[model samples]
Target: MTSQTDGTAPAEEFMDKVFGDYVGANAIFMAAIGDRLGLFKDLAAAGPATSVELAERTRLAERYLREWLDGMAAAGYLTFDANGGRYAMPADHVPVLAEESGTMFMGAAFFDYSTKFGESFHALLEAFRSGEGVRQELYGQEAAEAIERFTAPWFEHQLVPVWLPLMPEVRTTLEVGARVCDVGCGQGRALIKLAQAFPHCELVGLDRYEPAIQAATENARQAGVGDRVRFEMHDGAAGLPGPFDVITTFDVLHDSADPAGLLRAIHDGLKPSGRYVCVDINCADRSQDNVGPMGTVLYGLSLAYCLPVSLARGGAGLGTCGLPEGRLRAMALEAGFAEVRRLPVDDPFNNVYELSL
Candidate 1:
């Protein structure tokens, strides 16, 4: 607590480095260990089990399991019953930490994303500093496949159903046989849904990744929307093939080169009053934990997984994958939107914005 003539050092300054770090930096590592060891969820629904009991039930190494639970208990990731001599996951935290879902859809995958990729975030700062982009070694064809899998099912299962209930505004703006461009559309998921919704709307899914576009085309064909929607290998940064009645970028805007510029291009591509919908998570939603496990992992993915990969071909930084509401609204306004509105979507993990010009 050294006080200087200029000013006194704040308590937060010292405590932040010492004790106030409630979020453990190794939280991802812990999650990975928990998943690998099969420790957390074993005792999750069984109320609580003593370390000895957990070891017996899970046939895990006792001492090692004890240490893990002890650390996890300390971190409030689990609860240890003093008298009952068991550990259990709290109800509030259980759903957030979905363990053992068969297909690796838990928060645990972010650790892999971070370890395999988080360095790019630091490297990105340097790249931005030096006016040189990241190297191309990081993103392979696997990235396109990953994007297809991650976004396709959700778009097919969740988003289309969610938005179908709320497309009066969309229907009003659409003309029969009007051209619809699904910009940055990965695997034509959105277009499939759109084709089904407005059967008469001529739809095209635009993406810079040729592989992605091809996959989207195949998916569109499989989904029976092939004749209605075509996946085009196109560029959003340079421009889009318009004038489109509706331009949709689903979970794609945040990874663009200049999202604002793309919006302008989209605006120009659109007819008089076309709807531009951008679906993504807000990077800076205070309601959600920004630096918490889910947020950081996604941010890392944006840096390593999405941003540079998109830029390697020819695209812009759309909105940092998970940018905030205020920044997104401002970007849309700057892009020459006559009307910009943020529609609250039904996705818990992400938010959707509808910007019209």
Candidate 2:
């Protein structure tokens, strides 16, 4: 290989990275297939089995199962007994794959990357050329469901116990009785969690996407918070129906059509003592500072979904890592928020900001 920039060795190293990424992508697609088919769960529950046994257990075709098993074994996701003709799910992998409610569960992420993001490749390419961007509605239900599953553990396990406690005043208000709204509340998971935690509080969820709103309504009902929580299809950038004691935007601002307008609406929607909890990607203002594994993932997602979705709505197009603490504070101040405080929530994936009128 001839060197284009520095040397042939660097070119070879770059190609190695590209090949590694290709392998990783193939592995993720396989993982998504396994997740969708419940193969991992069955393997974990039924113990080691051959392709034919797994086929009988799952009622899937034998040849397909055989190929999938071989692929998984090669990827180190399963242990293959060549002599016994069986494949086993590793005990350590069970939590990350089969246990949906566990904190380590990452099965949904594979689906998100493989189906939700991968399916949008062509649209993203068009977006790159035209600068018009892909619309949110284009991704549809799969994206919503994938996102819900990806974040469900956080809402279920961490929201009430770990995250809310970081904001004592807001938690106390919820403990009593307070009108709360969650903007961009996909499937209403956070509100459902809040309703379950604080029976006295009135909770409402709002999202621009109709499918998400419908899903949220059904999900809230299923969670038995139907009477307590409400789901509405409304854009927060327009105006919030509020005077809410507490309002939250979880991983929403950067993907919003008008983040500044939404912030202003949130500020106006709140009572004088109301608190706005903004949960966004944890990142630095400068690109150079964000050069690790998390940053790489965030940037790739931005290119695929977040940035384009916002641009399609004629938004500011603040990509995934666009809203660091400094930018958020400045935007909040401009929106007439009197105070903006970064909470002491120790989440690597998200930053918690408390804004008050």
Best by lDDT: 2
Cα misplacement distance, residue 274 of candidate 2 (Å): 0.7
Weakest lDDT window of 10 consecutive positions for candidate 1: 100-109
Each model's TM-score, in the order given? 0.63, 0.96
Candidate 1 residue-wise lDDT at 342: 64
lDDT of all predictions, in order shown?
0.67, 0.89
Alpha carbon RMSD to native, model 1: 6.5
Clash-forming residue pairs, model 2: none
Write model 2 residue lDDT over 209-248, tens digit each, in one string. Answer: 8888898899889989899999999998889999999999
User: Which regions of candidate 1 fall more than 4 Å away from where they truly are?
Assistant: 1-131, 135-138, 172-177, 285-289, 306-322, 346-348
Best by TM-score: 2
- Please provide, for model 1 over 149-219, each residue's C-alpha lDDT reduced to its tens digit, 9 standing for 90 to 100: 44544565555556644655676655355688888887676788778777888888888767778787887
Report the Cα lDDT for residue 302, model 1.
63
Q: What is the lDDT of residue 235 in candidate 1?
A: 75
